[model samples]
Target: MNEDAQAALGILAQQIRMAGNNPDQPNRVGNANPALSSLRNPVYGTTSLTLAGTNTTSQLSMRGCDGTFTNINSTNTTTTGIDALTCVAGGTNTVPDSIAVSYEADRFNTIPTGGTSSLPTDCLGNKLPVVTATVSTIVAGTASSADVTYTVADNRYYIGTASVANVVTPSLYCKGNGGASVQMPMVENIETLQLRYGTVSTASTATTATVAGYLHATEVLTETSMALLANDAERWAKVATVRICVLVRSENPVAPNAASAQYTDCAGNLVDNPPDLRLRRAYTTTVVLRNRRL
Candidate 1:
């Protein structure tokens, strides 16, 4: 080959090596691209793990989902009681034992306006104004023992119950009911989810509290996270109180090299580290509690 042609081949080989792409090697293992396989369920997020070995029989211990377990049998390519999730394999099938937690929902709809559909007034009617049975009109404050006299802004007048059970702060996706059902896909392959309860002071500060039965890093979210958050959210909404905020964090550390190789030191010097991972997109929502009793 001519010198120019040889030099061109050398550059091409270098580029191929950088990409980890091998064309001629036989039985190569590392050249395959990594892949993400997910399982889906009606309960909220992905919840199951399955893999296939060269053998016809394979078993995977299902974890997560309110701390439950089942064995997956791949020999038949069928799973027992594992729903809403599918096992996928590709890219030399180099699957990681752990995956980053991912929560995704379809496009969100704008909060509705007008009448009770609006905020301050919960959509669940947990805060419907109560009418007093007293002879004269009376206004009840948070401390007032007697029922408060109030007129309904709308046609419906609901009787006063002790309080309404708050549903979990619903992560509502525009299901295209206005059009089509929005698809919500979630995965918890990371360390798990951690929920921190904070008190919203008049100063607008969120003071974190160590709440028992709260979310933790080691806990796979499944239904528990959704359940606990809903309970706290209901209590928060029923009281007719100040705006409250909940802090949600993924226990899963951002994968190393998940971000770009660039880093800024304490002094703001940019340094490049080529061996870093990039951060992937994730989903989480914060619900605010407003409307307080005076």
Candidate 2:
């Protein structure tokens, strides 16, 4: 392939990677993409450790959602210990084993009660609106009532500091200086993009959550719909995954052929007789929210 063609393919790859692998910030509650809004909450799961065998003197460790482990020493009985058996420190004693350790999603960081006087901004200086009922808690596990400070935004897997934004409303087509209509490329060669959301219903009992169905971005992108989604904790809690699809084309045109090629779009619609000679391809990816799963 020529350098230009290689460069075009590289751009397409980069865009797909960005949309697929970019993990949501722990604090970011939902998808902020202007063109496509979907669930972006991190999945909530549990990490447990059991204290068994003849090892009373061994210190027990607790791993947080952020992957950091904290040593639970015998002295930390009142705070981190579970029952009468204290997590011992620096000794080797046998029997009287405490063989049970449970992790429940009891801690949450929410927007301060009664709203904040000042606006909140992320680390990237992007302004954040006052989010009501923006609670980040663990689901599926037994909950603890105690409010503990936990890590929310682990910058490790995050892509851009600011939320993804696009100017979809404004048309890029405008009149040129020569009084001729021309298309100005705001984002080069990206033709279409679509997003689908998968939501689960709140479990009535301790059973596993089930995904209701996939909905297009337009179905849930309205103001009223967004409000309903935000206020309904059960609905928000049910968001399990998001599917992203991006369609891109080469800047240069290919050899024109009499027969047209058919392509399958993101919505599973067949596009017959696609008349463009520019080499085009669609990329798709699915992201699961670990914190939302059981």
Candidate 3:
């Protein structure tokens, strides 16, 4: 349980870091990428951790690129084009996680002359294939630039949990090309998972903003509704930090003679009466979203 909880924390932090790509800035007049999704709100989190009871749901969703993509469109694979996004419409037609990326052989020879192209594989490294749609131009009048394009497979990931009574296990969900959300078991025996979003406020004179305080998902949504920002993304843009807390218990109940342990939970409440004798532990960490800042 300890190892699983640690790993889960790391994985959750990574996802939070990649949650937003700053797709929606102050300037939305004409700046929109066709390869990315129309949903600009990067992070959506919810948690119900009170002394009363626990909520077995973590709709904490994040949207961002995962790895370099290979455009499934053969026509978009121009010999001269490089790092082009082929998912022209990201609203309805979502991209999926696909096969390895293939590129032009000996394309290095092409770059020296002018017509250059590539399809490098994202082996261990993942990078968002962000680029413009137009073709590259080497010379003023030369037609050497070819249209480069690639696929944007799966980009959005979220946290979910199994709803079995008394045996809640937090899981991860992701969709490919607008497919059904697949539940991925991240950590077992995670009875309670709580999250808090740190809201930030930037003064007119300050260059960067600091976290004002932490609020639950519902409160954040309410603030977003009151904000005088963009109609769609005002809620998610205000969150600058995320606090993740998960409770992991042993696989089996402990010995009867073993003293029942009392502990404090993720919500800072002391759990006086434990349900069982099984060893239980709480894992927590505060993740800061650098993408939310300048």
Candidate 4:
């Protein structure tokens, strides 16, 4: 090759080495994926996914372990670190589940609606918390009225039946706050929902007013217990992201023919059928809590 071309190649090689092999920007150090070392540059862009259909494009991006990003859509998502004990069976070896709940048309009726409604029971069902220490399946059928409540706090988990309950389950989880009501257990509130990052593995309510660190309202993981993981970062090294999703239902499910269907208020009125529930376009990301020397 000519000297000019050779020089250009040499310069590019140096840049790659200095910036790391990845086309993406610098990662949050500890969270950088060595496997993705060559693929860098994560930004908002639309690619012609289709051959000749329409010059359409979709938004794509990546996030650091200790970072957060928002998508083209207005959904707000968070990615942070949680305790290791909250992971599923695979623990750090796998991608933790993700749950995204968006405001959809009320399930109680057709067309747009108003007011909050209860979620569908057995939707994803209630999964158990991380009891095995190696991550376990979120126990389904874990939400019982006698064992849970939402009247006081956002993330509260009680035990037994609402009518004749007493002792609370140590592993129960609950921290929910929609616009109107908080759906506990397995209530499918709206028309449709989406799952991103992973799945809707578990959802538990808190018993009293407790500050959930890495836990999301829809699912539970070890990272949710931030202080616990912070104290034992070595044990909780598998977690990469802690995301939060909110499934807000309108106060009342309105009929499709409602005159105020087109209204757009805090209660979120709509004129047509809402789209399926997708992961919030935004999220807060955190790194795997590990002791770093000062």
Candidate 5:
């Protein structure tokens, strides 16, 4: 269970670190172009994912960086978080026990035609398409090819969870060239999954260099909450880290009079005597946004 939780965290954290700048704010940090991209809320936190009497659940969606991106496809019709190309989970689209979310990522390979890995791939080592288009630019009376030919395609990941028999499993949706979402079941017996955004408040949303401290997504100052210069999108850009916490159940039941009914949850709250008799453990990770920090 611990291993499974850790593995899931790694996958989520890696994408968070590679998150691109929100395209809504023109003066946001990161070199990603705001024109081609319509991302405003790089890290968009949707409503809580409530399971059957489960406490640990939250829906989070983010935009993957392109330095060079677009709105992803969704089954929902809600326009919430449109700036960031995010949609709230609703309209019979499943929630709590299960939900659908689009995981932002770059589907193309940018190896400049020569790299150790002979093929492009998704999160799993599956073969994928590569960018083969190039642009010609002349500088100093010399013509040079901007070899971005290897950086074209973008992937749309549609993530969700499912319950089979009695065990619940979380799956990762990998989008392919033909625009097909492949469902990859990640781990099993995951009881709860929660995520909290780490954001910083600045005097002006237009600029942010060093973050003082990370605050809760709601606690963070915004023009709507504090009437400060800090806007919604800018505050999201100030997010430097993401905290992921997951709880998994043991496969086999504990021996008689051996298992502890109480366990600590991802929120640091003491969950006294859970309903089930199976052993459970919580795993957590705080991932740094490498692209944002840089």
Candidate 6:
């Protein structure tokens, strides 16, 4: 092969390797599989909140995605009755088990209900402070001093934080007709980036979860929506495996005169080549959440 042609092939190989073998950590550390390592830990928070009835107003202060505490109100609502727990004039109380509430990290801050000296205490007796609440709903009970388990919705933690590193986005290089060869800032290249979720119904009975089929990121919409998908806990807890595919193309025309090729892209879309010399390829990998599985 000519020197130019050989060099072009080398470049294509390098790009593919970079896409497949790039460090999954946001800081670009270690040789972890980008497919699985990127999604190592799903962002979520779980805490318990005790309710107080006398005030007809209660708050649960929970940590946000950014590690800040946000207040969640457990105010008595007309629709959801709060008669399960008895609020004594002066006595300790716990939140009822029936009142299940899940919180979203983003929608945490609602109007400030002011500070409460009578805030709910966790199992360890640590007094949790009240901050603010954007969204709060009392699902079942109306007890004055009942214990409520507050789960901050599960979110994609692969995006990384200021201190921690994670890998969720993949990037690639490509050249358009008139534009110089450039790297697409986002999960780039020729076609779609597809993901499939594997969910298990029973953790003990089954060894592997059932594949729920491919889906777009928008399907889950928000962390709250994700919590409600399929079974309440399936979205994150039962997510055993994730399949990722990236369909990409060469930045330069390596296969000139190659007849208009027909191919299937990542999102399972068929495409007819644009009669260009660019070479295209698809890379796929399956990532299992070992922690979730165990």
What TM-score would each prediction reach against the true structure?
Answer: 0.18, 0.35, 0.53, 0.18, 0.57, 0.34
Q: Which candidate number would show the highest TM-score if scored against the true structure?
A: 5
Off by over 4 Å in 1: 1-180, 184-195, 199-234, 238-276, 280-288, 292-294
> What does candidate 6's lDDT look like per residue over 6-116, in tens digits?
333333322222211111112211225322221211112111222233222212111011111111112322112111222222211111001111122111221222355
Candidate 1 residues 43-73, lDDT tens each?
1111222212221111111111111111221
Number of backbone-clashing residue pairs for each candidate, in the order shown = 20, 7, 4, 70, 2, 17
lDDT of each model, Cα atoms only? Answer: 0.21, 0.31, 0.43, 0.22, 0.44, 0.30
What TM-score does candidate 2 reach? 0.35
Clashes of 6: 17
What is the overall TM-score of model 5 with all chains considered together? 0.57
Lowest summed lDDT across 10 adjacent residues in model 5 is found at 49-58
lDDT at 52 for candidate 1?
A: 23
Tens-digit per-residue lDDT, 1-294, candidate 2: 233333433432232222212234332223243212112221122112111222121121111111111222223322332223323333221111111111111112112213344332211222222111122333455432222222121110100111136423211111111111122323344445444556554442326666666654233323244446543223433445655455555555573652444566555777666756566566666655443322
The worst-scoring run of ten residues by lDDT in candidate 2 lies at 153-162
State in Å the error of residue 50, model 4.
64
Rank all candidate structures by their TM-score, best first, as comma-separated numbers: 5, 3, 2, 6, 1, 4
Candidate that scores best on lDDT:
5
- Candidate 3 structure lDDT: 0.43
Model 5, 99-128: lDDT tens digits are: 122323233422222356555444434443
